[model samples]
Target: MRPRFRRRNVASEGTESLGPSIPDGLWSKCPRCRELIYTREFERNHSVCPRCGYHARLTARQRIALIVDPESFVEWDAGLSPADPLQFVALGEPYPRKVAEAQERSGEREALVTGAATILGVPVGLAVAEFGFLGASMGSVFGEKFARAAERAAVEDRAFIVFASSGGARMHEGVFSLFQLPKTIVAVESLSERRLPFITVLVDPCYGGVTASFATVADLILAEPGAMIGFAGPRVIEQVTRQKLPAGFQSAEFLLQHGMIDAIVPRPRLREELAHYIRLLTNQHSASPVSFVTRQESDR
Candidate 1:
């Protein structure tokens, strides 16, 4: 007969249990400061760590809700989804399967979310990248959505704004992904033909082809505190050049000091600042600040 083993219970064996177990996800550790913070408080603060001021990434919906006027957003290109033209496979997993997994994980059809919305009563075209969706990689559908949104903004004569967070272009799509670089650049140019303002807010971990293309070619470029904005990450650059980089390399503050970005706007002040810029850029600054401030404060 085969020998049988029995599992032992620590409680029955007289080992003391640590008090009632704490539930999972009740607290989140700050990546920068390594402090445990209550999840509710973290969400209330817009995902910025209270201790170290780390601006955690937000879901696309959360970002839209934070930036746009309540119930004012109407999405576009909702049916557009990614396709595997190359029939690509990685480590025996098909591209379509990967995309399906990403869709399930992110609860979004594609990485890019484009829509029309009002900010502080001023209409604008908006696009926010969902990093949870395949690192917000720019694939064909991603490019199409952005191009269409830009075209719509130009046609409607509204300022266009984008909150960009990406790990660059999708490698699964191969060369088709690289096609988006110039395509989006042309789209931005179309906006300029109508003299519409194009603004981009670069969030954390924005790099690769997206940054190389349209993310930087804006009327104004703003970044959150400590965002990593660059074509190649510091690690790759250091590896290539075989040299040590300066402290804070590729950070938003570093980019700002180097004149790559216009301003570093904290998350709380972002809406007001964007409204101020929109009003100034579009020559619509005649509105009284008292009414606007009151409305904004009440909403907050």
Candidate 2:
């Protein structure tokens, strides 16, 4: 039999770290509630803070498991890795070397994981961004993955859902990286032609070229509580405008008040929320939970 057991990861409680090298049985302090929580239990609750209901950041894999049906995710573009086409360097480290180090740390080839999955037995195309991978910055590859996810969803008549969590465009890649904004927008804009639903789930710290492009143009935009969403970082915007920004200017709740997004979804209810929207948009009635079965299984 294949070995199924894995080594333990030693991350602090309630924090999300899936790698086996992390130290185990550590406790984590909730940033919002200031309460100590067992790391294992925190993961069991899907990384949401039990005391104050704050949603913790999740790894790309953990995020995928939250909404997709068990064993139903078929990933695409997993081999795509970031390249230092510009031969860029920053902070005294070469860009390619930096990307290599980041890949090692995050256990992902790139920041985004694109795939087909079923949410509540309703097929949907999903793309989740991993923030731990170099702040989940969008490079050429990241944009390509996002674009292809939208295309796949459109072609398959499935709802397209993107989880956006980024610090912005990868500065290391320079202009080549920034240009992907338009590329992704073109891909996202194509979804409308098919009348497929496109949803953006804005996570923490979404800013820069990402917010200025495809992320803001979703058919329905949903943000997690306290997510910072804006075209620029608050400090930079304040400097440019030379004004004292209001408190929580770019927070998820703030965006909702300004009519920037459709709604603010709590972590616990996100699956239900997305399923509801997908069903209405697709005219799909309630589907019983159906696993992917082979022709032989069906015949049997």
How does residue 236 of candidate 1 score in lDDT?
84
In candidate 2 the C-alpha lDDT for residue 208 amounts to 83
lDDT digits (tens) for residues 21-120 of candidate 1: 4444556767667676777788788888888888887889999999999999999989999999999999999999999999999999999999999999
Error of 1 at 205 (Å): 0.8
- Candidate 2 colliding pairs: 10-22, 10-23, 10-24, 13-27, 13-28, 13-39, 14-39
Error of 2 at 255 (Å): 0.6
- Candidate 1's C-alpha lDDT? 0.87
TM agreement with the true structure for every prediction: 0.87, 0.85
Tens-digit per-residue lDDT, 104-194, candidate 2: 9999999999999999888899999998898889999999999888998888888899998888889898998899999999997668998
For model 1, name the residue pairs that clash: none
lDDT, residue 30, model 2? 76
Q: Which stretches of candidate 2 lie over 4 Å from their true place?
A: 1-26, 239-242, 287-300
